[model samples]
Target: MSALSSSVQAVTALWNRMPFVGRVASQLTVVNIFDCATRLAAQAFLSAIPVLFVIGAFAPQAVRDQLVESLRTVMGLGGATLDQVQGVLTADSGNVKDASGAVGVLVTLASATACSRALQRVCERSWHMRSAGLKVVMWRWVAWLVVLLVALIAQGALHDAFGAGALLGIPVSLVASVMLWWWTQHLLLGGRVRWLPLLPGALITGIAVVALTWGSRLYVPRTLERSVDQFGPLGAVFTLLSWLIVFFACITVGIALGYVVAHEQPFDRWLRTSAATGRTDPADDADLAEESAQRP
Candidate 1:
């Protein structure tokens, strides 16, 4: 516990010290944000095709009604707008038993593959690693996609478990969200450091994600209404992309923080001193490597 406490303290101190590192990290994220968001947006759009088919074609009326109720209750959507959104989400393709079609499956698979590939690239950049061999990439792609699917399903259960109606839900959701982010980070980037070291970053990311999810429900309907009124059906595209942008940006920043913290890079050292880059100094590259090797 003593060692754990010290490690946590070191991370906190470094985080408080590294505004410049954070700024540089932010710039780097901006460099990759558009590409990541585009891939994620494509995946979402493609996934909706199958989801709509399932809801409209195979789901019982009771299930559909429950879904509509959830949306209206959670997202503050109703009336013609809710109907319009539901209309767009629920497809008229296939029948009760055969809701999914060959085309829908093919497009969905392709979009998921693209998303995995894009995420692999982003993770590599975030971790400052050179690209891996095809086999490694392929394995990670499959694993990450499965993990993502699980996360999507689990979030509904999580929200139910940590009912947002009460004050208790806030801390419970934060812990749940942290666990989810930890799993995601480990899956997407592979282990470069001890898992415990990433907890602080995951904690921050989880809070941000939970906050955004709660806030988005309140904001998205209004945004959707405005977007549709001004841009017609194309407005939905704008609305979806805008949501993706915010999520992807937060994820990028969170991962960046995870990297720095996990590597035990003390940004406070940089902040505190105007030391010349003296290789002979104790706080040099060799010392950093030795410390990293010591981190187990």
Candidate 2:
């Protein structure tokens, strides 16, 4: 018992010595980062996937084709894997469009907002901010969906422009991801946090996005194909869900790490100096101090 107590004290002492990293670690524990990522993944899979299929049903043939092309580009889908997805989207599309009227479409879109709301909670928690009311953020939710869908489609074109290879495409994807995530944080937070402080998180998220996108190309296509062959559409569903979990886990970690980095020594000091120069809001310092005080 004495030995165990000594070890615990040593660990505590070590943690105390690294205040910045300790605060970050404490915040992550308080937020249950992995749990949050899993929830986001499940929410997105359940809500966003159905919404995408429904939207595809409503879309014209050309639009549906473009959607498949974008997915293929992003996931490196080919052969049987690509066919399974295209069939899912296009097989009952006409029937779906005919059966679902405007009301159905509206309902599908509203359900998709669950993903937006989940992501907004992540940002709010990372910043230790209160949730914005529905009225304040409802429009932002819909707008975010529109923006995300547009970006998804545009990603194919972005890759094609960069020689359709990972060499150049990686950098393009990283830059695009940074800009998109930066804007996403501001939009989802209802502009409560300024743009500059959000930079570290966005850059971290961008790197993660690029790395995952590149890496997924090597793994997802083969795994997807095998799953489809062995378990049909259901297998594909499971595989995609598993992938989404990993994807969101990395994203959550990146965002949390960004918060930590931005609030730690050199970066925190730099942000404060910038605030003094009128480049950033001095109010952010209070936010940092308050967050630290609340840390376990």
Candidate 3:
């Protein structure tokens, strides 16, 4: 009875020291799902301006007309019914002029900036660390660029080789998705080391992300469809809100999992140590202090 009592006390103490552990663990299970949804939303928002710029800057009239026609077909709109859209696309001056276009470009740049800042905030919140500044941000961008280039090239090659009918595409897509998650985590966490150190934890987290994303894709959309069918367009708003909740939940989980995978000590142990010491590790403390000092 005494031994059992002692074990119970020990377990209680551990939980007391790391109250967030169970919550974080449960949350981590859904991390990728939330991350995918939030990231998709953020990307959609940020990419809109740039996409417009690209259309205006590079696409020819024929190409633009073809794109409009494609969209019309997809949306089941009447033929050439997007006349206003074409006019907007072809508008030469006034509000639609290039100078006015700069506003969207600036907004896009701001969104990108916000994403980097938000990523840094996530790192700080999760690991008690901050990235160095423009240098770190630039490096992170370069890393992502490399990852994106590789994914695009590989995806094209694989799709061409396998044709549209092959099952190999799924696995290839999964692998690419994992690589992307890994790269993003690596960048956000200031893990600019050799690939060896970065790959293992990144791979683990990436796989988790891929599984969650695939599952969400399979399930959430259908669920949302049902809700919309039952509740009308208002249901779409609820669906979006649900997506946001899931997205943040996934991010918290992924951050915790990444920290666990990368560190030597378990979170419970670290939490206990921090509580007992009444302070974080000196390195973490210094990093936080530095970040505070650097903030504008």
Judging by lDDT against the true structure, name the best candidate. 2
TM-scores, all models, native as reference: 0.66, 0.84, 0.55
Report lDDT (Cα) of residue 262, candidate 2. Answer: 73
Tens digits of per-residue lDDT, candidate 2, 184-233, equal: 98899888777777888899888888788777779998898899899988
**Local accuracy of candidate 3 as per-residue lDDT tens digits, 220-240:** 656656766889766655665
Give one digit per residue, the lDDT tens place, for model 1 in 71-150: 55434455566787577446453453364666655555555666676665555455554445676567767677766654
Instruction: Choose 2 or 3, whichever is better by TM-score.
Output: 2
**Between the candidate structures 1 and 3, which one is better when assessed by lDDT?**
1
Clashes of each: 0, 0, 3
Off by over 4 Å in 3: 1-10, 13-100, 138-166, 189-194, 230-232, 244-248, 265-296
Give, for candidate 2, the lowest lDDT window spanning 10 residues: 273-282
Ranking by TM-score: 2, 1, 3
